[model samples]
Target chain A: MAKFDISNIDRRWIYITILLGALLPLFVPITFAPKISPEVKAVYDYIDKLPPGSVILLSFDYGPSTLPETEPMAEDIMKHAFINGVRVIGISLTEEGALLALKAYSNVVKEFENYGTIRVNYGYDFVFLGYKSGRQAVILSIGEDIRKTFPTDYQGTNIDDIPMMFNVKNYKDISLVVDISSTNTPNDWITYAYSRYKVPVAVGVTAVLAANYYPFIQTGQIIGLIGGVKGASEYEYLVNQKIQSNWGMKPKRIPAMRNMSALTVAELLIVLFIILGNIGYFSQKGNKRR
Target chain B: MAISSSIWVWIAAFLTLAVFSFLYKDNIIYKMVEALFVGVSAGYSIVIILKHSFVPNIWKPLFVSHNLLYLIPFLLGLLFFAMLSRKTAYLTHIPFAFLIGSGAGFALPLVFQTNVMAQVKGTMLFAPSHYPSLGAFINALIIFIGVLTVLFYFFFSRGEKTNRGIIVKTGIAFIMIGFGASFGYTVMARLSLLVGRLYFLFGTWLGILH
Candidate 1:
């Protein structure tokens, strides 16, 4: 048999072990305490404080590539907004995001329908304005004239034609702008919407993009922020709503939890491997010393 | 059995697991998953662009209404196919440059105000009235200090031997912690996504567990 090589034998074994650990959670769905940070809690409380019929604008700026993270955030925020009777106007910055946002809304709306209370539809209570180009330019223009940005809704109905557009004017009229985005357009909302228009801006950002907004959160330029899936799950927990589940708790949380279970075993294996590697290094060093 | 809408969910679940398998080995399985993702994503984007952008802005305006200005986008859209024509490939640059120029023109000022000006203005325009608690004050102070020191550390005029050395180091530490926390949180987030796929497969689709 060839000499046992810990470094280069095969990395697949480690992956298989990890995969098994992660898979165990699907069967045993355990509820765990989520460490809700102040930033996340602020977002929860901000939405909770809104009066019924307050207009909330949600920008779905992510494509299918980031659907796993942004979708749940969009879902929960929509669920919360509707449950609280806050009018939600869904918009998309990315062209692809329009479909994703619509799909997410309908998915959650169907679930919302199961409760037999809220009768949410496309044109009535919620309006999906679909994709608009010009990026930040659109955000800026909408502050002055929403009609200029959205001349027509997704279905070709003029803004004036829609009843919901009656009270909706500019960013000032919007109670909060929850930016569910992968890009930095949320910063534009903070600039034009929050800073310029004084509309409180909340962000539901991918985990990678969340840190950039922390400074804004600390300074109160952004009222609240939801960072990635964990943040989404945390927000879901606080609202007593299930947006997207089993992402963390099932595959990830279970593996992580099970990892804690077989942690001692893995630790011992690692220690043994490390000690052996060290011995090999030291033995070579001793030979050179002579 | 009916190849219902939920079958897409199952296909998605399987694709997710297949992609996750790459963590174990970068073999044919992972490559197949990667290729499938690339194909599906391209197909999806094409559909989205045609349905959402092309039809709404270009086709409807040009052919349906006979709007002459819509010809510009039509011509620009045609520029996308120039790359396929090897001899006239440079024509792609016209549209490319237009896109790049317009994208920059749209984004630059906004970036300047939002990312640079707004953030700086926010830092300077702080009021202590918001949070009366000492903890809030301390946090604000720390954030202010962190910003200043991190900025100073990049300054070439004053070397590490300056009076601000300790402050700079402390700032660096805070920045590092913030970055590290962000990174750790992101890892957990991605892990959550993988977990979500597994849940769909095991709990919802297969019904292996109650």
Candidate 2:
């Protein structure tokens, strides 16, 4: 180990370490056994249990800023739903999320294109409702009437024209509302959608927002949570495993699972830094006492 | 390794690098990128709102459908533009008040039901039969206790300073743990963003690590 005061270590050195930790794994990947947590499993189980043709409304409540963390979640959940015959209705409460949702859905659909057995058609299997203002209002309106909330899909196709949306009207049509959020949009969903309408809501949020939902999750207000990238990795692992077993499909190492190596290494470096910092503080304090 | 040939990819890579350049030191490139980001975001957002919300929700309904009820919100929305005029700037406050009033009115009951009543149910409905195991039940019970103590601390914090009980100390402990967990997540978030950018530079632009 290098002999240097961690407390007084240059910020650039720390940044470089993080950069290296992140960069190295991408070039030469290393992955561990993805441990599935109960909360995440709860979400997976809920979706898995939904009968074919059951609709899941997934909200891309995040943008480019938190895309790396959240985008994987969207992919995992949508893939699971698509794998089963369960349909999905994509929506975004945030403006940035609207296009991002479409992009994510497109990417997932592209991946599904590889599998000859799996087929997902736009406006039939899934629909992206695009962005709407008034987060809570939008949620409540979806509860009352989804068609009124989103008259047209992202591609400007009328809701009535979409075959899948023929029977879809409100919360009753939606088996679950999963919000992948970087912001507090999940809280709004829980408040307006879950609490008011008694709709089941799950959340995949940025790491920071995950902790804030402890009370909600504990109360069973939000049924499942994909906390952060770690949670996403768990999901990717789950999907990969299931698809491999049931469908005999080759496992595609999804982004979250792929990035887990880098994340682990980076997090380890952070832990090392913290340890060094504490040691430096203790040594300094001892010297002062002498 | 092949570099990205598309002009758009090149532009994106350049912008991503320009933003990352701040890690070394602040420079004109970073500043320019920052300015461009803010300006573009604001402009794009306004366009999106108009096309998605204004045209479809308000304008089409009021004009095409001949819905008189839509006129109320439309008129109130018009008041927002008054901010551009010094003489009529006060009118902006009317819409602001209306927005706040209605939003609060709409949210009050739902917010209460979710945050308070639901939380109470979670804390109270700690039946051992609900748990899969004793350990899970205990964990739930601990959380149940922590909730009460934390709430007690919050309510008591505004009062006298003389009697700081054991419950207050426990509450402080829980609060500290919460803050610490939040800080850890914050670190994770920042690092996640970095990993994403590096992925873009290496995987997308450089085409080495895809």
Candidate 3:
């Protein structure tokens, strides 16, 4: 407890401190470990049990602002689906997200070579349905008729032309609906996917939005949830541990792990700062009273 | 033909920058991009609705199958367009009411299954007799404590009671810590987008990373 003037500390310095603390880890490359909470573990296990050729509807319901947290999750989940031979039908709720989803999908598809073949391919193995709006209306129609919701892929190919959508009759046929969102889009998924059609639903949401979903997870509306990047990283870790062990892949646990490390240190510092500010304010009050 | 990569890169960079412009000030550039985003999204949604829902469900059955039953849904959809017509807008209420009713009906059963029943089942624990191992026991205890403590923090009815003061205090502390971590992580997540934007500018435009 040094008698230092806490009020004199510049806010910019704190931001700098946090920024450097976070970014430095990326280059240094220490092991970024996750606490691996039960909810995340459940999501990991559910996806693990999915058989190859199982249709998973992945809605990338996040815009660019949330890509930092959500992109890694989407990438990791798609990677798992690819490696496990699961057929992924990608779509987006927000218009801006459609291109980003495709870009991320293509990037993961490209990286598939470096990690070796996961026995999956685009069009044949997976499909991108692009972006559709109307929120719950779009999802409800999709439950009854997918061809009605998306007549073509983002590229404007006929839905029937894509082999992936052939067996995708309705939401009932979908194995799992994984709504990867930056906001509350998962609520709509729960209403339309699980409520209307009784399809199993999972969510990968931003950390801020994850708390509101506890009720859904509790009720069985959501089979499991991957909260933000950490959840995504955990899923990647589990999948890599299970299937990719023979190939010698260490898993891409970056982004989440590194970010979490910085976050922990920053939290401790901010709490300490807040406590010091309180102490300073109380002490000044006592002096004034005297 | 596919849109050129350079052209996409430029568009992405500009839109990304325009979004970031909100951090400084909401200028005409930001407004223009925002408006375009809205217009494009609205147009795209109309196309998707026509292709996905309208054609297969309404148009195809009406025109090809020549089924009179298809008229019900087609007319219902058309009624939704009545929302746009201010004079006869009250007619639009039928479709809106059906949508709300259907959506609510969908949510009720699911809310029970997923939120209430499933959660109750999930929380129903093992008889520690089965999980005699230290690690398993500790994990279960930690989860039990975390759940109860978090709940206790929200229960303000008996909050001032001194009997469970320590537990409540600990619970409140845990909640604060959780909030701190969540907030800090969210900041990093948002900042990461800014990082991605910077990467696009430098790596894609200036060829710095390459």
Candidate 4:
């Protein structure tokens, strides 16, 4: 083998390699099918088992910075909920998350419309409760009364006017709470909503925060979890396999699945670089010993 | 290659390229876009906070509904501005104290129940016999041992030399495994973000890929 010195490699070359690893997969046609983790499957099973018309509170707790990973998860969950006839009540605990929630809701609604099957009536089927201040306080207040916490929807329309708000009072009426966040909002949900109200909580978080939540899941404090884009892809795959089939709809191209190829390639390239660097280090050390 | 016609797409593509340019070298374009992002986000946050929070919760309740009870929170909120001045800064302490006290009081019990008590209860209630499958029983046993060893590692009172460093070594091994998993997930998270930007640039903006 030719002599190699990884330490002498330029940083620019590494960047170029990673850039190619990310970009080439986009141009080249390939499919990335990830094996669904048990954690992600747990989330799928919980939502799948919920009876029709059951209310699910989706807390969009992330901003644009984490839109890449969390948005796909949010969209997939919303799509699954809509397909299964589950009632969705959306809220954002963070100010930056408000618009993101609206965007995701609108995108999924548009997708449903494109499907030309079930038309979701806004006030009856779903409602965006909009953003509220006081992160943990808002969660606690939601346990008591949702209307009092969010007096109006995102459009300044009163919650009383919204037809769906009639029967929904608090966590009692809701089936589950799924928090898709980049922050500690999931922990707060577990603390306030799950611990106090006995409501089941699920989370879709950035991958960095995924391991932190495993202890909670092991303890049954959290019902399920979806982590990062891979987690989102798993959900998309499950929805297409199970939920979409029931709807008699063909499996569509999911953004998360499409992006997974690049993710895999980039990660593999990183691993290769690490191995090469280690080999070069050991080889240099052996030469010095000689 | 076909170019996008929409002015907004063009703008987005340009901004995306400008941001990506940072990978090669820092330039004025990167700085300009960075500044714009910060300014726009800050402005958007103010509007959102005003619309969703201040107007609904504080302003409308106090002025329109004429609820005097809202005055307490309104005044307390104003006390935050007192931090800007030295002479009147002492007034800020009252609100600060209330905030800290109320926040701590509210969070204490919940944290105890969810983070502490619930976790302990879960560990204590682990019954491998309850599992239907042998695989599940083994998994539960592994979890039980892992939790104990991890907890033992954190016990500072027991010196490492007491147990011939065996328990401490086991704890270190588990800790290393946890750190490795965390590192792996972090890499995946960052790669996912990169994939997102690439998707936007190629799939959404440029329409280079379908």
Best by DockQ: 4
The most accurate candidate by lDDT is 2
lDDT of 4 by residue, A1-290 (tens): 96567766877899889989989888995677789999899988998899998999999999887788999899989888888889899999998888899899888888878778888888888899888888899999998988889878988799999988899999999999999999989989999999988999999999999989998887889988999888988998888786456767765657888777788889899999989889889988998999
- lDDT tens digits, residue span B1-90, model 2: 688898998899999989989989999999999999999999989998998889998999999999999999999999999999999999
How do the residues A30-137 of candidate 1 rate in per-residue lDDT, one tens digit apiece? Answer: 455567888888988888899998888999998766666778788878877777778888889886788888898888777756655567866666898888765666
How high is the lDDT of residue A269 in model 2?
95
Task: Point out where model 1 deviates above 4 Å.
Answer: A1-17, A65-68, A155-161, A191-198, A241-290, B1-10, B71-106, B124-131, B157-168
Measured with C-alpha atoms, the lDDT of residue B76 in candidate 1 is 92
Candidate DockQ scores, in order: 0.33, 0.78, 0.22, 0.79
> Compared with the true structure, what per-residue lDDT tens digits does model 2 show for residues A1-290?
97776589889999998899888888887888887998999999999999999999999989888888999999889999998889999999888998899889888888888766788898888898889988888998898899889988988889999999999999988999999999999989899888888999999999878888877878889898898888888988998888888779876657887777788899999999999999999998987999
Model 3 pairs whose backbones collide: A148-B52, A148-B53, A149-B52, A218-B119, A219-B113, A219-B114, A219-B115, A219-B116, A220-B114, A221-B114
TM-score of chain B of each: 0.80, 0.87, 0.75, 0.88
- Single out the weakest 10-residue window by summed lDDT for candidate 1 chain B: B187-196
TM-score per candidate, chains pooled:
0.78, 0.95, 0.72, 0.94
**Interface RMSD list for the candidates:** 4.9, 1.0, 4.4, 1.2
List the per-model TM-score of the A chain: 0.81, 0.96, 0.91, 0.96
Residues B87-126 of candidate 1: C-alpha lDDT, one tens digit per residue: 9999999999998998788667756776777678556625
Per-residue accuracy of model 3 over B1-210 as CA lDDT, tens digit each: 232368788888788778767655679999999999989878976776676556666788899989999888779878977878789889988988888898788667766765566566656557778575878667666656766777776784364654666677778777787787768667645555544555456556656532
